[model samples]
Target: MTDPDTAATDAHLLETLANLRWNRFHTIVVLLFGLGWALDAFEVTLIGNVLGALRQHFHLGSNAMSFILAAWFAGLMLGASGFGILSDRYGRRRVFLASLVLYGVATLATAFAPDLAALMVLRLIAGIGVGAEYAAINAAIAELVPSRSRGRASAIVLNFWPVGSFVAALLAWLVLSALPADLGWRVVFALGGAIALSAAWFRRHLPESPRWLIEAGRREDARVIIGRIAAGLTDATTLAPAPVVQRVRREVNGLRVLLRHYPGRLALGAVLDFAEASGYYGLFAFLPIVVLPALHLPPARLPLFYLAGSVGALIGGFAAASLLDRIGRGVTVAGFYLATALALIGFAAITGMGAGAIMLGFALVNLLATGSWIAAYPMFAELFPTSLRATGIGASVAVGRIGAALSPFLVGYVGARSMPAALVMLAGFWALGAVAVLVWRRRGGIEARGLALEQLAVEPARYV
Candidate 1:
């Protein structure tokens, strides 16, 4: 149990942090954390770009390729589920740096893999690192940023994902054009490793989250970090002493607590995550097998399609960043999901048109789909308290990865029978997410707009 004095002090420190104006310190935190998302995107895009080369070099068949893909997602699920608990138990800074090193070293090793088995193992390890980043980065950013700008700040971090994807596509094109397929893919993996290591080095300078420190019963550490943050702000005027309500409670197992106390939130997060992952992954799966062939597009030109999709992702991310604070999280996320469903329907209807028309439809669907997740990520981080934030986020991400892993198979099975049915099935996933968010909102879910983390933790849910 928390001491009364410590609880009051924790409240005061949080209030101070929440009221501070944006400054250089917060900017650095966002940029550093954002790189994690970018690196994950780069790794994912690089793998997709190099699959044909890998298949050729290894002389592998369909089953082998499927297993390789499954290994990466499996690693992601395990990492997110395991490392999230570590982050909550140890500290965000330690797990953050360690996960980066693991991913960097594993990816670099992958570049030198002599056999198909070695390559698969390395990919799985690298994926674990990226999965760990999802939990750590989201929790850290939410705790560090002020309440008023948290939504936009988190959205901005998510925006870096598309930037990374675009860079990977561009890099793959240039490298493959200059080198042999075998050497080019190796170089791409090497570059990804170098970038991750570099980011990890810079991240050493980042301070531990004050909120986490306090929750861990380290008041002095929290105070020192809070002081350092305030010292960096130019408008660091003295904050008025705010009245503190005594709300401290005994610590318990986070997962158990989540099940007992926040079942509604856990369900909401899982449903939203599963919907987005399956729908987005399902669309990509359908495209390579069903849509591209119908459009008479060759596999060699897949990079161009990815580049177009990246542009749409960037546009959608920016739109989410702009709308999240103004329109509120629930409304913004639900709206984007609904828009994506409609866009998918339109895309399905236009599949028989010219290549340009089909690509345009594809980009439109990507735009709305990307926006949905960008808005939803902040919600995942905001729904839980500091003590369990990473765990909660990790659990949701793991659940989502399960959906991601199965989406391709579902799409393949359904698409093999009927193209329109596959597209409609993806649309149904998005619609389910939209309905879930709307129901949560109607049933008094927390909005989390311009509210401090402490306030959100203690306040009763109400219509926003």
Candidate 2:
């Protein structure tokens, strides 16, 4: 039995979702964001796909490889913190574009690393670019997309990440199969760097955010951009002329301001970050470990399983976009995380059973978990206002990176001690993440709605 108010709220959300559509600029922005996200994912996951080859080629041990992995995560943490502040102080577009170029170059440079130390440094630098991009891109999409479809749009955009990883997996299979031993991993790294350069060109055509422009006291320019966007609105029946928005300049007081004013938002952001980081690393980072064993497949078969997970992730991302408004961010996340927790547990159980069961569970785990994971990013991005959106997201990403950094270590530790227990423990992380979302809901509902971004522009002081 359902409550009337809940039912009415659900109905209204459905109606809102039905009416959701993005202008061309916004759509292009999301597509590019998706592509960039996918490329980033591909680059990061390439290491996992080539870890064995890297060790064999470089005469590296497992311990040394682990250190390299840590270096990458450390770079991510630094980049997230540094660029988050930069996004607020400078502007989203400049920082966003710069980070892309930096990462692209660093990724490409990996192909020529002379030693393990050199590889570590290059990967660390690449991690920073990757880390910085998350905040810039999430902030860009949140500010650009209409409020009614923000949640769904963000989710859909994020879904392309798995596609990138899937592509990497496919490439890994192809290279490992066909390429000469010494040149294979180099090709993978070079490709990551090359693809990242495309983000720069794509971003060039993107206009600076109108919301950001108004905030920075560039009203005239903001108006011009808005007019251009509105010019293409085929259905302008509900559209209004751009109003004169007063500028509200923001300061860059990195950590202190974030801690003092919006403590709850910061806390919520961290919780979401932890949940997302743990779940994502567990599923995608550990893909080769979990899926290959479960399927009893040879090493060559690993990419095919990874490809299946990527397909599931794409489905999840699109499904989230289609259903986010009707489901509401909190409800959708809570439901998704809860289901993911159960699926992870079920996956563990089925893995021990047999090959047929493992394949079925492998697909189902990713199918459920990936969708649930897709819903988190948009909702997480929305939790803070524009003033702290980048910073908050950056801080959250930093905190989340810690969890991600810890996962491989934990997985290794657990595998060393007991494999099944490690599997079950990952499931527990998902359950804890579900609890975090429920806690967030008890404090507040969805972060923004119905022109709230516009309203924030009206009274920027209210947000700060």
For candidate 1, give the lDDT of residue 224: 74
Measured on C-alpha atoms, candidate 2 has an lDDT of 0.71
On the 0 to 100 scale, the lDDT of residue 206 in model 1 is 83
Off by over 4 Å in 1: 59-63, 233-252, 289-299, 459-464
Residue-wise lDDT of candidate 1 within 151-207, one digit each (tens)? 999999989998888898788777776788789889989998899888888888887
Best by TM-score: 1
TM-score of each: 0.92, 0.85
Residue 7 in model 1: shift from native, Å? 2.2
lDDT of 2 by residue, 221-302 (tens): 5556566665533211222332223211335564666677666667767776777677667555454444444344555555
Model 2 CA deviation exceeding 4 Å by range = 1-21, 233-250, 287-299, 353-360, 445-451, 454-464
For model 1, state the Cα shift of residue 192 in Å. 1.2
